[model samples]
Target: MPRVVSALAALALLAWSVPSAALQVRLVPPTPRQGDTVMLFVGGTKGARDVEGSLGGQRLAFFPYGAEYAALAGVDLETKPGKVPWRIGLVDGVGTPRKAAGILTIKAAGFPVQRLTLPDGMVNLDPQSEQRAANEAARLRTLYDTVTPERLWRGRFTQPVASRKPGEGFGFRRVINGQPRMPHAGIDYSADRGTPVVASNRGRVALLGEFFFAGRLVALDHGLGLYTLYFHLDGVAVTEGELVERGQTVGTVGTSGRSTGPHLHFAAQLGRARVNPPDLYTLPVRD
Candidate 1:
């Protein structure tokens, strides 16, 4: 069940009193499941210059949303179900910093299992290929570790491609050739070859590479520890460090990087947590 924290109770949890009526803190879905991106909104911060917070141990960068402040936090797919400690800090108009603490409740989520029979070469990598993949992965990790201290995206996020099938395959435990492999961390959209793929939101192109497993991919840094990835492209249209608008074409769908058919593998990461890309559209943000 979703646990909605009341305003007064939230103030008590923070153990602080404000000059205003009350300090309002809320988690969009109340109780979020694993692999979900949760929005944290803080009200009663009328003249605050900056707002920041941390969930578990991951830092969150808050941006101005109307009269309040909002930030996105990720719940890892393997996060344990329970209450996790969260802290928030804000600098008032006079540079007076105030702090608040609370807890975020997470709910358990069950992912479906998928079994596939692929060629041995596709299932296993050679020594040389293994090293290349490792290097690529490390580079991606380094990119995710760096947080841009600004909000570049506006309004809601959109799907990268048009697909008749519903969004699925995220967090799916894959058993390839009777051997368990890492879970699918992204949503796959079946599209025709050369189908244009657009940026899910506005951001700067962080990296573009032809990877062993991901094939040709583009990663977008949406600022504030939020990133969107478009993988398995037929071709790329944007360059690294270029600012792209929302819905701008970044690549084309194709059977690249271990894919069985033409498709676009879209993913989102908040800090270190791999979150569902579809969740971005559900956030309560507007232009």
Candidate 2:
């Protein structure tokens, strides 16, 4: 049986108070078992026609209608054993320009699962470093959950006529100069340096900034703990709070942040947990 967890409990305990205009979110797992397919739902909406979702780096597409949009996405049992973050972005019917979003942090399962141990040097960093990391994680968790337009689920997840081949890997374990570094957390596409990068799905521009490590970073809130990030951009074309469509052009790829070459670093976060992006696309999810 799949274990069920409430997204609200996870978000609330972490101090992510709901935003006044935030979309309502729900996660309905079939049972209280690990590694089961779970359904994520958005309620109290209107004229929605399609949903665009992504976890880690994978993307999902399905049609939506009426007051709610629901999608069944697989949550891992063994990997990402902490709170799970899932993001969903929706668009209403034709010519109705609006989008809505929110986040969901699926509470951990009843039974614990063992995850790989990190080096003491990293985990046992100085108190300040550890605290900073924790704070950042919490902040990111909160931002991932609540940043969205007051009433719009902009974007669509359409099947690429010919799926663009992933130019680089997602979630690849990495070691820099023979020392371990953060695993590659996103998908890389080898497109022309200035080619316009499209919004993977409908979402609001919650964050568009430059960072030491992320270079030119752009975050899209697809609501419900689900967020998509684009990095190493040559230029960002959208402003914060702008509504975007699934295929809207937002930026171009570049060697920004800590990158060595021009490529798009596409990543997704569900609450705080980052899963395999490819899994989001290949997993057998239903609308």
* Best model per lDDT: 1
On a 0 to 100 scale, what is the lDDT of residue 48 in model 2? 58
- Candidate 1 stretches with Cα past 4 Å from truth are 1-21, 94-96
My TM-score estimates for the predictions, one after another, are: 0.91, 0.53
Q: What's model 2's overall lDDT?
A: 0.58
lDDT for each residue of candidate 2 in 65-95, tens digit (9 for 90 to 100): 3456665454543354444445666554432
Alpha carbon lDDT of each predicted model: 0.89, 0.58
For residue 98, give model 2's deviation from the true position in Å: 33
- Tens-digit lDDT string for candidate 1 (169-235): 9999899999999889999999999999999999999999999989999999999999999999999
Error of 1 at 163 (Å): 0.9
- Give the total clashing residue pairs for model 1: 0
Candidate 2 global TM-score: 0.53
